[model samples]
Target: MGARVTIVFAALAAIHTLTPTAQAADAFATPAVTINRADWRAAMDQLRSELNAAPEVAADFALTARRRSVAADDPRQRPALVQLNGVTSAIFTGIGRSPVPVLLPFDTTAYLAARRKGAIDPQALPRHQADFQTDLFDAGPSGYDAVFSLPTEATSGLPSRVFARPVEIQITGSVLTYDVADPAGGKGESVKALAAQYPDLRRFIREGYVRYAFTRFGVPYVVSIQCLDSAPRPRRLACREASPIAERFLKALRIAGGQPRRLPPEIAPAAIERPPAPDPDFTYRPAGDIVVNSGARGQSGRADLTAYSQIRYPLDAPAYVHSQSFGRRRASDKFDQPWSQYPWRDNFCEARSFNVGQCASGFGHQGQDIRPGACPVRRDGPEACDPWRQRVLAVRDGVVIRSTRQQAVTVQVNTGTEHIRFRYMHMNPSALDADGLLNGRSLREGQPIGVVSNYLDHPNGTTRHLHFDVQLFTRDGWIWVNPYMTLIAAYERLIGGRGHEIGTEMVSSSVAAPAITGTLPPAAGPQADAVHAPN
Candidate 1:
């Protein structure tokens, strides 16, 4: 028992001796991942506080960190809350170009409401999400108006505004103006299909651009890159090289969800105007009915049928719809006779140096031709029409997208319901430049653009008339669709009366067209502004 007691004491002594060492080891040793959770939590709280203070700063928190409780936020922070809670975020140009792709989270309810105004069928929209604003640099890249990136909203009560924007990207050796639209409306293929087709993207879109369309989170997205092969070799970038760049952009897209919110009034459904149906009194020839004879354009005849829009009569005064051909007439005379008399003709499919996908032949004049109102008093000069008197007018409320040193000025109407561009041609380029009718100019409906003149490539290259045409946002970029229907619709509205369509045989034969006449709206008063487009 004494020996046992001695052993126990010795054991206890050994334990007592090791206690200090073990305590020292415990002090040295620590968890493999002993997270500074306190510090981490503090940082998160700091970020949330900053975001709440200035919702726009949420863009600063992109990958850093990021929400869904607007009701819980302070009332003043409501807009900022949404703006901050993924409800409001801005993509700021980083110190340099950001390596990250942008995620433009949309309010699903607001998106649907905008489409409803555009006459989009509610059932046709994707169930989880309606139509998505395309990621086209043209779309998300391109702003509908020159004003700002997203639709402008100035609601009286809101302290802040919600907006979506893409992260800016840099592409060397390629020239892209950053316009937007791909799968603009309707739907597109799945992301998998787009990936499969990415290798040969040119086959998918018109204009030979590398275009990939895919859907994510039930939203359709399109990304297009032009070969710019036409660009210098050192600067040239093709689809093969551009596909990866575009793919990266696609990868960057993420959905930022916010609770249901109302859209701005301008694009809201209540403000939308439905396009009119074909009026029985409004008569026009079937679209694509090219006089079928380009050589005999001097004696051209064929009234054209048209499409919709809230548009002003293109002409400031009542005008004659006739052939104002660029081609020389059979005789010394410009196209062998009176250029203004008409049963209305269609030149949208007339022969041209370029290709027009809308034409049956895939190559023709891109637009319709309309002459000045007075044909009887033909004047001799660079233009046959009275440039000082007769004029062309803005067809819709829009911005001037194209005003070149060449011969055309294109005004673009880019609202939720309309993505159409109106081109005015034949007026002298010098004159347009003089009037400050250049890109990014603002215009209202019925605003005087320029006078109808005969300036084609040069002065008097074509007959004195407005070579008016239009283009719509399509998968093929800005494909020139036949504006015959749109023009007819605008004219009928302008005249405040109905027009009956006439037959080609009636104009081709000895019978003269029953002069369809209507006076211009009193509001279409003369303005010094004149505009110009392609021949």
Candidate 2:
């Protein structure tokens, strides 16, 4: 009765092992394109609206840089010194309040001296000039502000003992004209004092007018002033209070300032927003084995075959048959062929004569030489073996971590720490479709992708064969496994061969499987119970 029960249990286990779950669906799908024109248009519209509402206004006023001469003979024509270059203007555009433009004059010589040492090229005069202009106007919506370096020289009178020292003259003015009697006309004195010091009053007014235009039109302004002294030879001159004409002109001018107000909110609206791009699809799984042949009669000492010596066989047995047999091919007739027809015959001949295993020396051949019928070979080129080529499918579903199509190899990583890599080489370039895989799609067992080419240089000239190699990574480094063992295991399962023992061994060896903490399941019979009971 125990024997019968044991047999029954064994049969049940076999039945359960025969059925397996279906593979998961492919993760990748064709991507689509999307565009949003309305969002872009809305942003542009907002910018235009802001510009149209409460447009910019500019005001002009004259300022003077003057020096006094110690010449009693020509006091009326006192020596005058003025800024010839380097002036900047600023304008501030408030979101709700009135726009205000501020003009700050600079010492042009000092500005140029500092700028030449750091920001601008001292040697390139034109570039320096252009940069000065840019710095003056590009002060953003903030009002114009700057310092000017006024150039000075001595006028005739005591043999010109000294030079005029540079000074900054601040000028305030309005773009619109107004009478001193107006409520806002108090600002005129400040503007007049700003211009009273310079002898070149006309040039000052011209620059002031230009500045007003730029401010009014939302442009920037800069100017240079040049001055000449008209006193007797050999006299020292001070740049202040040099010219009465300039002082009179400034005194006659008037400026006004009105209270500012805010612009309406309806003129400017918020800009539209944009969405992000889609994320990439990802997948992960363990690699499956490829089976070649099954149920071939086991020769004596088969169990003694080491991993390195697994694929050794007689030369006359056609390369393709040997590969298929080792890989456990189900259909023996599919790959049976003569040795002479094999593409690697010449290389094999050389290996045989040299006793180098590259041919038939047998032990530790390094890499498997899959034949034409089992795995397509390209004698002419990569395209020649397209029809008979093996798919060289990905070991596991994963993102293409690294690809070297130029070298005909692709490495994929399933997990960050797994460190397990699969390399598929000698594949035809065309095999990788637009999506970068076989036919731009997923591959199955025994599917055709592209033929192996002779691009990889071998010991001989080059051999036309698939050089499929597997390398396992350990903490120390990589270790090569006799892939034929795994291949044969998969093949035997598919073709009616007894695989229960192998399956049990694999389950026991798998690193991913959970530990069996309890006793083994009940055996089929009484004899089986004795064999498993605490032993």
Candidate 3:
């Protein structure tokens, strides 16, 4: 009985196997109720009423038909319309760069009724209708090669304003006559004779009238001039005479006692009038004393003398003895030395040459060559003399925007969104632990992060050191700031001059002093001003 039931269930499942669903019959079917004659007639009536109210309906109708025809040919095309968003729509009839027609669709019944009532002439409507339908259905040529419907706001606003307020003198140009009468006839002999001499006079007259009308009467006018003659007998004289006459006419029509105003020059319309200059020294004040520092040579092992002697030296004063006396006899001697071995006893800042004893040479030491003790022969080498492996501290707190372990020699820290990037190069690969801490966690000022080694090669095959560079990005271009400023600034802030002394000792006798004996009184003179070192 169980077997029979199972077989019945399988048979039922098989009968209901997957198949394609049939499409709905109404899909793609045109509804008979669409385009109701009565509704269409009503819509047409309304459209005709609107057209009658619009003064430019004839031009608008011509433009609409042309656009509809183009749209019919290519249904994917957008209709021409003046967008309130201040953007012009696409052209359909190729009349203007913007082909979109701004006219709304006409209601057929109202349009037909208006034509029958003599409100809208059938003769005028048919020409435009035939032109539109021909282009739409038969792809036939149109009477107008190009047509454009002007913005309704631009056309209607002026007329509405004029109707609201009437002006006294209503100065107008010859172009108004052309638009009102036969456009060709308006450019008669007088216009030709005048324009032949002064070509730009007509333009000035036209613009003047437009400005005056718009400003006073709130009416907008367009000027059109036709030149009938090909050449003039006296061109120069005609222009000279016409220009003065046009100018005089404009000057005479100015509203009496209205307002004394200067018309802005067409060329530089946005120029602002400048105000008078303010008095000098109105907010001036004298600057305070400018104290300078000799810097941290005494503590950082950059100076060989006692801390007292180092601090006593005048800022910017020449070193009594060159770096050769401190151990690096030649520039080549310090090449490729580890950071631990960086002449802590000698002033690395004083060494100016890459070779021996030469100051200010082009091949001078590029960076401060520090001897970071000895290099670790093995990964697990003793750490007694070693400063700290990967114990490098950030020079300044900043975001770590980029991190790449593949480039073991350098680590880049982004200080800000500006292109200024701080580069900690020639780093010990092991110094940066799992969490990127140089030593255990934090690195103190002047504390060693890693022993600098010549394990890697430079492009020039010369000895390498920490190549610190400060760059500034400006509108003009990138500029290199002196890194010496950063070094001196950091040194002064960390040591005692501006603030209290760090220890009891005024100066240390030895480079690696375990303890200090006593403290000396602060030195006076310019050295006293060196208290806070400039960072």
List the RMSD of every prediction in angstroms.
25.3, 35.6, 34.5
**Model 1 stretches with alpha carbons more than 4 Å out:** 1-286, 293-306, 326-339, 375-389, 403-406, 509-534
For 448-505, candidate 2 gives per-residue lDDT tens digits of 3344454332111233445444333321112222333333322232232322212222
Model 3 lDDT, full chain set: 0.22
- 283 in model 1: Cα distance from truth in Å? 8.1
Among all windows of 10 consecutive residues in model 2, the one with the lowest summed lDDT is 526-535
Q: Please give the CA lDDT of all the candidate structures.
A: 0.41, 0.24, 0.22
**Which candidate should be chosen as best, given lDDT against the real structure?**
1
Off by over 4 Å in 3: 1-327, 330-367, 371-390, 401-419, 429-451, 458-465, 475-479, 498-535
Query: Model 3, poorest ten-residue lDDT window?
Result: 28-37
Question: Which of 1 and 2 is the better model by lDDT?
Answer: 1
Structural similarity to truth (TM-score) of each candidate? 0.51, 0.24, 0.23
lDDT of 1 by residue, 1-535 (tens): 0001111122111111001111131011110100000122232333354344544434333323223433344333433223333422222211011111223323333333443356454454322121222221112111122111111232222222221111112111000111222233233343453355333232243433455543221112345543432322222343344444455444433323222211122211111122344334444454444544551223232322224344677884456565444322334323224444434555676655334554444455667787655544658887655545476788777767542453567777644334567878777778777887875677888888787777744576655667777765442345565666566656766666545557655544332332211211111001112211245
Candidate 3 lDDT, 1-535, residue by residue in tens = 0001111122111111111112232111110100000122222333345445644433333223345554454422322222110111111222122111112112333443454455865344422221111111000010011111111132221222211111111121110000111111112122343343223322322211111111111111212111111221121112222232222223322111011112111111011111133222111001110011111222221211111000111111111111221222234433224322211222323322121111122112222322322333434544333322323334543223212221122212211111232334444333333446421122333334444333222222223334333322211111222233233223333332221112213332222212111221211111111111000
